[model samples]
Each structure stands twice: as C-alpha cells, then as structure tokens.
Target: MRGSIRFGEFLIFLGALFLFWQYAPWDIFSALDRADLIIAGGIGLLICFLLALVSRWFALDELIHIVALVIGAGLISLSHDVIHTANWSWGDFSFIDCSGGPFSQERDDTYTHALSANAANPNIQVQVLNGRVDVETANRPDYEVRIHTCVRGWDFDHLKEVLDQTYPKPELREDGFSFIQAKPSRGFGMSANVEIILPQSASYKVSIDSSNGRLLLENLSATDLNLSTMNGSITLTHVAAQSVKLHSTNGSLKGQLSAASLAATTTNGGVHLELTPTASGRYDVRTTNGGIELDLATQAIGYAVAADNTNGRIRVNLPQFTTQGQSRNHLSGQTANFAAASIQVSLTVHTTNGSIEIRPQ
Candidate 1:
C-alpha cells in the first residue's frame, strides 16, 4: 500500500507539472499586469493544492475541502455566461467550436464608412486586438474604411450581439478620423480585419496598433507613420514618409521605404528593408533572434554603415565602403570620399542570433 501510494503521488505530481508547463500564462506575467498576475498565481496554487490532496501527499481538513469546493463553484457560476467560446491554444490543447452545440457556429459581419479629409494633412488612427489590417492609397475621390469581423462559437447569436455592442463605429474627431475597437467582448472568439483606403492626392499621418494581426500598407504617402503589433507580421511597399517606425514582438517586417528617418525592431522575426534614404537621415534596424536583409537604392554615397550579429555571418556588398572591423560577426565602415559631404546617412543593423546581409539595390 505504501509503494502504491508513492507511485500514485509521483504520477499526480508529473501530471500537475505537465499541466502547469503547458498552460503557464507567460505573456500575462511578462506584461507585468499585477492584477492578472495575482489572479493567475492564485488559480495555479489552488490547482496544485487540489492535486496534492488528491494524491494523498497533503492532508487537508474536511472543512478546507468544503470551502475550496464552495469557492470553485462560485467561480464557475460567475464565469458560466462568459465561457461561451474561446480560441485558445496551449501545447496540445486547442479549443475549437465544432461541438455542434448552440454556441458552435461561426458568424461573419462587415461594417464600412466613408470619411472626408477635412484637413490638408489628416490624421488616422486604428487599434485592433486580432486579425489583419490592410491600408492602401487609391485614386478615389473619397476616403473609406471597412471592417470585416469574424466570430466563432457555439453561441453565434450571443457572439454577434456582443460584437455589435463592443465594436466601435467610425467617428470623425476634431483632429482626424478614428476607427478603433473601443471595447472588447468578454470570452468570444472573434477577429476584425480592417481595410482602409485613402486618397492618393492627400498626405496623412497614420498610426496603427494591433495586438495580434498582420499589417500591410501599400502605395502610401504619409508625413508620419507608426505601426506596431505584438505577434503579427508587417509588410510595407512603396511607402514614403518623413518619419516611420515599425515594431513587432514576434513577427517579421518587410518594407520598401522612401523615408527620411526609419526605425524597425523585432524580438523573434526577420527584417527586410529596401530603403531609398534621404540626404541626411538615420535607418536603424534590429532583431533579437532573426536575420536582416537590407537593400539600399542609391550607392553608398556619404553613408556610414554598421552591421553586427552575435552568432551568424555579416555580409556587406557595398564596394566603396571599406570594412574597418571585418569579422564573422561585425562590420563597420564609412563610404570612401564621403568626408566632405554636406549631408550624410547613417545605417545601423544588428541581430543577436541571425545573419546580416546588406547590398545595393
């Protein structure tokens, strides 16, 4: 009996560890949200304690078990209506709406609105939690934005209702036009894909923030542009801006930019930049664990180039730029005969665990 109990405890401990490792809320804790961290920790502790009790490794009084049961029941009751459907994946567990229940269907809805650019240089801002965003400049007479929303669940009607209540409409503000997701639903599996069409004749300042969505911008002429996402890729083509900033936590960045000043960074994704730099400007590109491929449109005229990688090769294809610290991991030099230039360009690219490739377009 003693041996059997020990074996059972070992199995229980292994199971508990597996579950914990599988479902650990690393992103939440890393975000440093105190309330969410506390709640997650409490729930984890409770699960462990209950598993210990089941394995007979910890002796708990009957009153303690009763109180725990009461608390658990209360939590379940509170979350009953909120647990309709969720698109959550952890390790080998993926929750999908295929149970054919009342809440297992998928629904899609679209909303669109037109805005008139009141100012000479209007400002546009967009915020989305999930899905894709595509922005393009068109030769249209009017500016328009469209939202395509997809919600999946067993309770399709409820999800649709929640989306109708939570999704924000396009509002014309004093400074510009805003099309943002102001409120999010409690526990619905939903994604909103946005498409914005801007007038080609007008220059605008645009800012977009997405938590988990791919962003694509094409043929845009903006005074200032800022795009960022936590876990989604960004692609830009034929974009001209005075100042541009792009960032992603775990996604790639690809841009063909004609910007005066540009900066791009990613934690776990590659960066590909094809830049037509200004006379005097800075282009900074960095990634923690991904490669960088850069193509400069003009010759290395009055340009100071620096590229570095911790655990990968560094290749520079500019002939006039003599490498000073040429090694397997680092390269830095200035273009020859660039000392007397009135304006200069500085390009810096770095990656911790990937390659750096720089060449002329």
Candidate 2:
C-alpha cells in the first residue's frame, strides 16, 4: 500500500499547479507553446520533489523521505502525455482504458504463450523466485522426478531456457511424471502461489513449504499428503488420500480429507476440518490454538477415538459413539457394536489453546 502522506502531498501540489495553469493558461499560438507543456511538467516534477524536501525540513517525523521519493517516481511516470490524456477524456469518461490494449502488449503476448504451453503440458511445475509455484498435474500422468524451481522476473522464455538447460536430460522414467526444481533468488510473498494437480487415480504425494502465499491442490488422489505454510492459507479441493497432515503458523488451514486419516495443528491460528457425509473414511483429528470440527456420517466407524487438548475445547461428532467424561478428562463410551467389522478406525484430537466442535453430519 502506498503511504498516505506522499499521495496527499503529490495531489496537493498537482492541484495547486492545475489551478495556476487554469488562472493564467499558456497561449497555444505563442512560440513558447510547445515548450510550455515541458516547462509545466518540469515545474510539477520540481514541486513534487520539493514536497520531500519540505517534509524532511519540517521534520514531519512520521512521513519519511522514501514516501517522497515514491511520489517523485510517480510524477516521472505521469509527466508525459498524462495531463493531455486526462484533459481529453476527463469528464466524458470517469475511467481510463488502461487495460493493456495498445499501452501494453507484452501482457497479452506472455499470457498467450503461457496459455499455449500450459495447455500442452499442464503437469509442468513453475517455481518463481521470491514467488509461489503453480503445479498442474491433475488428470495428468504421475511424475517420477520431483521438481524444485526458482524463477525470477517476468521473462518466461528465459526461465524456460534456464529450466531446459538446468534439467537438460528431462529424465524420463517409468512414471510419466517428471520432477523439476525452480527456486527464485528471493522467496515467496503475497504475489507468490503454488498450484499442484495430480491424476485422480494416481498414487502420489505432494508437500509444500511456503510463506504468505496460497497453496492450491485440485483433484489429487494420493496415498499420503502433507502441506504446511507460514502466515498463509491452504485450500484443497477434490483430494482423496490415505493419510493427510496439514500445519500452519499464523495461518488458517482448511480442506477435506475424504478417504484418509487427517491430522492438523497450528500456533496462534485456527483450523477447520470438514468431512462430507458422502465421505466414508477414518480420521485422527487434532489441533492446538484453534477449534476442531468433525462431521459424522453413517459410514463412520470407530474402533478407538481420542480427542485431547491442553487449553482448548474438544468436541466429537459421532452418531453411534458413546461419550464419557471424568474431572477434566474426557473419555469415550461405545454407542454401537461393531465387533465383527474388519475395519478398525481411530480419531486422535489434541489442542493447546483453542475450541473443538464435533457435530453430526
């Protein structure tokens, strides 16, 4: 977010210059007419620059010099053709058509390239420098080689070239999936993202470590799944696993563990787990510093269930499970008999400082 003081000062100076030019408008027919625009622009730039000096001299204390520098940079970006463009289309239209038609063609060009390449090889992974990755492996073949990537800048061709050079062999394996590594000189941030897709029937696994960026998993059917993030959120959709573990620090973790045993934990954060009634699976749910939710369905069977937390509430949802409590310890009682059942499932839930809710589906 741009600082308020810098924008305010720039707007004030621009307004003052606009009023001055209005009161004593420069004559267009004069010899200095063409030079007048340049002079006016220079004056505006100077004034904007002076705002920084004034702010510093006055020791505004709160507003620093960097803000003024940013304001000056904005002035340079707008000094040419901006006023004329604004004047020509000022009251007629409230919005500028700056959606990258003629002013920006690189965006369209690159997007087209990306679209084509992505369509051709959606399973390919792209790791951006200081940015997140986008993995599209779902419905694609399971990759054998693990890919770790680091990419920087907007040059996709250069990145692709570097990737080609780095992984010259493009190692082919029995499994169609190929792993590539792409890491950036800088790390993940707000603009960073990682997208991973896997074939619905493929037995595979994926783990992500990110900071302040999103991790998206779609249509992944794997035996084991692990996802972790710091100050970021994770969204997993249409994923079925045998065992899944998700953890975050100061970030929300949410997803469906349809056919797998689920465990999650967080510090100074909250967790939400959803098991659809249509979901027939065994779960071991746990958390710390957050609330826990369980969805009970007809297919849920309990051989042994455990929900424990130090400074958090524990709630379990079971239609056919018994409950027992003693002092500060909560115990379970069998509500239904399944002695002959072949499947033995369990739920282990724990927390340090949060609430737990186990409700019927």
Candidate 3:
C-alpha cells in the first residue's frame, strides 16, 4: 500500500511471522541453505530496489515494507528448528495492533470548504495523497464543490498545526479548477477526504489520482473522466462518461457504468461492471487475481464480445447470442443481429485465477 503502511501494520507482520515460525514446517524451506537464501534475497532486493528507484512506482515508504520483508524472510530461513520448539509466552505478542493505530478519531479535527466555478464545460481535477475522494452529481447549476477534510496527527499540537496550515481549496484555472496536491509531511495521519459536487446540467472533464485512497464517483456525466488509485477501491454508480479510464493496483472495481470508451485494469482485485453501452464503443477490462462479472444492456445495443480467463470458468448469457468460439476458459461471440443493430459494442475482458461471467441485463 505504499504510503499507507504504518508501524502498527509492521507489528501485525511481525506477529504473523512469529506465528508461522512457531507452527509452520521448517523443512519446506530447508531446500535452500543459508548462503543460497541470502544470495537469492539479495538479488531480489537489488532488482526491486533499482526498479523502485527508477520507476518511481515504489516510494521510500514502500522501501520500509521491502526491507521488512527481506529481513523477515532472512530471519525465518536462517533460524534453526529449535525456534519452533522453544517455549514462547502469550505476552510476547502483545505488540499487535488490534485498535488499528495510535491515531484515533478523537485526535482528528474536521474542516469544511466549498469551491465553485463558472464554466459551460468545466474541468475538475482532484489529487489526494493519503485519503479518499467522493464525487457526486448535484442539482447545483453553478458548478460547485464542497470539501470536508480531516486533519489528524499524534496529538493536539500536531493536529492543530496541520489543520491550520492545510486546507483543501481549489485553484482556479483558465479551463476550470484543479484540486491536485502533494502529501504534506504533517499529513501522515490526516484524512484528506474531498467531496466534489458536479452540476447535472453541465458536462465535466474530471481527473482524480490518489496514491493511497479510495475513489467514488456517482451519478456524474463527463466528457472525459480519469481515475486511478494505487491502493484502494474504485466505485462508480450510474456514471455516464464519454471516455473513462480506471486503474487500481490493489482494489476492486464494482458498479454501474456507462462509458462510450472504457479501459479499466486492476492488478489484485475483481471487477463487476453493469454496463449500459448505449452506442458504438470499445471496452477493455483486465485483472490479475480476481473474477470479472459484466452485465450488458441486452436490448439497448449489439455487442461483439471476446472474454477470457485463466484457471477459472467462463459463462456467457445473452438472448440470441451467436457463439463463434466457445470453451471452458474462452468465449467469443456477438449479438444475433450484429449488423442490423443501430449501436454496436466491442468488449474484451480478461482475468487470471478467476471466473468470467458475461450476461445480459
């Protein structure tokens, strides 16, 4: 989770490692000697560190996790079988963080702000560092956005200092407004939850990028909407957009979405989309470790589907769906009247280690 990892999480990791050491078979890892294990871990660490430094994908915060992992692996592998036989008291595990963390809601202070802009076609861009973004469509024709951010820290002084210094206010632009920002040093324990409200009468170009926060957009129409979160879920409800790109590295994507052109991918999560492809469009969705559930509007448009899954089952249910190729893990077909329909949709969905279910709405 990059910047989202905390000391308490490390405590949990140590606890798990202790449990595994006490119970798990040491012979499974006996295949590798101490020198071999050290060499292998060193090579992996070097490669990962170089990639992390060069790609900018992994931050310094992630380095803490990587180092912890290498240490844990080394420690477990080097430990002898006697460790499992050693008697350990329950008090040794008291360091586990059952309450999440030291920072609590009691130490948090809330702040409210509003940002409004006047534009026929507005562009609303929001970037969160370590919190959440929730955008909704409202009746306000003035293109207004209301923000509620919580500033938190270790104690009262830190909370007050951060709250006084930071407020999520939009910066006006020639096109519209941008709420993008870098994470503050004092924002370590903060929750920069930004709630955006878009006008129903106007179309927007919205872009939101969060490093470690959940994203939610509902009942919003956009000409172009881009959303990406590194470690949180992305949810869309009754969203209609001309172009939408959703990417989440560690979270699921589930909801009702109507996009003319869509490309959504998640590395470690599932995707369940109820799509209303009202017109000609191309949709692509991919996930690595999760299942995919796609429900299309049966009568609204014609669809040419190509869906695939590895280590999972595939099912396609549609009225008058012509099957070109059908197998346990692959399905390619089209609607009955592929050419006669006014609107046609081309969908490509793929997943690994999960099932694929495409059915008619």
| Top candidate, metric TM-score | 1
lDDT per residue for candidate 2 within 111-159, as digits (tens), equals 1111222232233323221223334443443432232333222334454
Which segments of model 3 are wrong by more than 4 Å? 1-118, 151-159, 173-175, 186-188
- Window of ten residues with lowest summed lDDT in model 2: 104-113
Which of candidates 2 and 3 is the stronger one according to lDDT? 3
Candidate 2 regions with alpha-carbon error over 4 angstroms: 1-192, 276-282, 329-331
Best of the two (1, 3) by TM-score: 1
Prediction 3 global C-alpha lDDT: 0.68
- Residues 1-361, candidate 3: write the lDDT tens digits: 4235666566666776655443444333322343466566677767765766666543554765557564565556345432321112232121101011134332233322233455556778888755667788777544455555554433545655655566556775545678865443422334455666665777788899875567878898888989998657788989988998999876788899888889999987899999887568899999999999998887758888899888899888877888999887889999887788888889899999999888887
TM-score of each: 0.71, 0.50, 0.67
> lDDT (CA) for every model shown?
0.68, 0.45, 0.68
Error of 2 at 130 (Å): 4.8
lDDT of 3 at 11: 67
